[model samples]
Target: MEKKKLNHYDVAEVIDRFEINKVFDCFTLKNWLAIGTTNKLKPSHSEVLEEARQQLSIKWDEWNEEELKMNFVSMVIFVSQLDVPKHINTYFERKLSGKVNEISISVTVDCMLASPTYSGRPKNPYFFLQEFKRSLGDNHDPEGQMLAAMILSQKLNEDNEPLYGSWIQGRFWYFTTLTNKDYCVSKPFDATEPEDLLQIVYVLRKLKELILARVTP
Candidate 1:
């Protein structure tokens, strides 16, 4: 008999299997984003974000998954600037797996931040983002996928710190965090809006700072 794969599970199934509790308008997520920075965006990053907002305003509903990734998502990531001096860099289309007692979860993450040991391999994943153009026609569970990635990253890190992740639905992005069995999701941040897009970049930047603290001596 073969083991169960994560992609086959829906968000509810993943929650039930892991005994995880979901909180809407989660306080933890709200606080996480709040601690993000008060400094104004650099001119270069501001330009990048403005571009992404403009593009999403026009193409939010028009883009397919690939186009959303290449056009809209790329701009947000560019503004976030996850690459750090500590070698905690970003990787794409990576596989993550972990076992919890008798159950196991495996997922191919769309985008992740991890410290690479070799040239192309992610050694310790800290953050993740799973995305799709739209939820209806695709018939895929991006939340479940993102949850699985966060679980594995938590296990691999073996650190008590909360794990962070996000899942994109068309032009909206939902930030998530897992601490023990509590899974919290922030309200969707609309990429087409200037203010929400800035907040998205701020959260990403805050995440990088958190990861650096864990990895740095």
Candidate 2:
């Protein structure tokens, strides 16, 4: 008999399997703002963002998924300073067991941020970011992807603290948090706006701080 491999599912199918609902009433952007951004955006970062924003407005429809990742997503990583040295990119398959079922969940995230290990290997991801290729369509499900990634990350987290993740579709970004099996998603923030992008940078900076606090003595 052949051995059965772990099942594979896209972000949307996973969301349906888990019965994840869009309970906007449980989401809060005001409390998220209190986390604050101590790492202020530099003038250079602002210029790059403005250029990318303008280009995206015109060319987004023509761009592919990798184009979106490279042009928009990579820029956010750069502006937020979430590169390999500080947080390794183990954007490969992350496998986790499900809580409610006898099944496994996995995803190859667009980006996975985690603390650096001396062994030079990718450690448990604390945060994830996924880019949903189609932005204009109402059917886009970046939130599902975000929540799925967060759920897996939450299981991988040994610290047992809240696991966070975000997803972007076109110029819009949304955030999610998984704490004690309770998931909450935040209202969307447009990356095309300078102020909104700055908040993203700050939130990323805060994430770095949180990682350091957990991993460092």
Candidate 3:
């Protein structure tokens, strides 16, 4: 079957209704505006993209024990509040065959920002993924974490076909290398404080709106 094209205007409307402007204001949305407005799409997007790529790639190798632990904790705290769509819930119910699995994880596979390459075409700018592991524990294995993500990809595909390519939809990922100590260290998902949680929710809602507007028709 042919895929349905996304409605960008509908998505933009969602963003506007959800106040995405306020949420994105906390991050590099301005930088994106500056880059997007340029006649010749510059390397500004690539620079940030490369940073995230390099960080994830390097982390995949060296494996920071502390960051791994932090990520696990962050995932647990943040995913607890996420609401699942009825269709996804029904799909999982059938897939698991009545198993009492409570955790539902989905990955974001595309980069939030993109720029045309020298050849005048867009390319993989960056990616990121977050998982809600079933049995929460203190285990810290980067390789295992990566593998688990891969497994989840297969399961999701079997359950319901994704919009983009399989890998893109399987991984909830973003890429940015700004390394602004504040944003990186702040750890949006790991926030427990009331104000911090509110901010995180606001940002996520805005991100959803922006994505819907940009990708959907």
Candidate 4:
């Protein structure tokens, strides 16, 4: 007897033949994507994300000082979301007894990679700072770092006006870290390569599909 050759159709048939409706749900799809990204299946961009997830799971509770430093870079990248700026502003306004409009967020760290001197350089960038801490330790102080970064990033004018500059414009942060054994990677706000952006898009699209499915039927 000879082994049968399998094609795309054969694979599709296998999936289609299964009662997928029973298992398909938002949680399932999200987990599937997470697994796929973690396992580095087929698609290549998910490799880093998967590695980050594995690192998070293993080091989440250990809280070893060495691991904290090693994991910090990935955590920084992982938690750096678009909504960070708004949250920082809200918190500061309440804490300082100032209006929301009075607060401004800036990204400091004056490295060449973080320099605002050049166009397209990672200027004032915002990040989900609290999430970065949570990635390190459960007892990590969120209010400390998040508030510090926000307060430090703001500008003060002679007349007490918020003078924001595009060079120092948006709420963004910069991070550089070592991964695996020898490689060091640095990403600035808006500094990600096109491929990483595409991976984010792919994950977001999958998430949207899962969400839409929940609303239908």
Model 3 worst lDDT window (10 residues): 90-99
**For this target, which candidate reaches the highest TM-score against the unseen true structure?**
1
lDDT of each: 0.80, 0.65, 0.28, 0.29
lDDT of 3 by residue, 71-136 (tens): 332332243222222211101101111111232322232112222245533232211222223222
lDDT of 1 at 109: 85
Q: What is the C-alpha RMSD of each candidate to the true structure, in Å?
A: 2.1, 4.1, 19.2, 22.5
Query: Between prediction 2 and prediction 3, which has the larger lDDT?
Result: 2
- Looking at model 3, residue 48 earns an lDDT score of 39
TM-score of each: 0.90, 0.76, 0.25, 0.30
Model 1 Cα lDDT, one tens digit per residue, 116-147: 88665788787889966455433368888888
* Candidate 1 backbone collisions, by pair: none
Put down candidate 2 lDDT per residue, 141-190, tens digits, no spaces: 55655566676666566567777788777777877776655567777887
RMSD of 4: 22.5
Judge candidate 4 at residue 215 and give its lDDT. 28
Q: For residue 84, give model 4's deviation from the true position in Å.
A: 18
Residue 208 lDDT in model 1?
83
Using TM-score as the yardstick, the better of models 2 and 4 is 2
The whole-model C-alpha lDDT of candidate 2 against the native structure comes to: 0.65
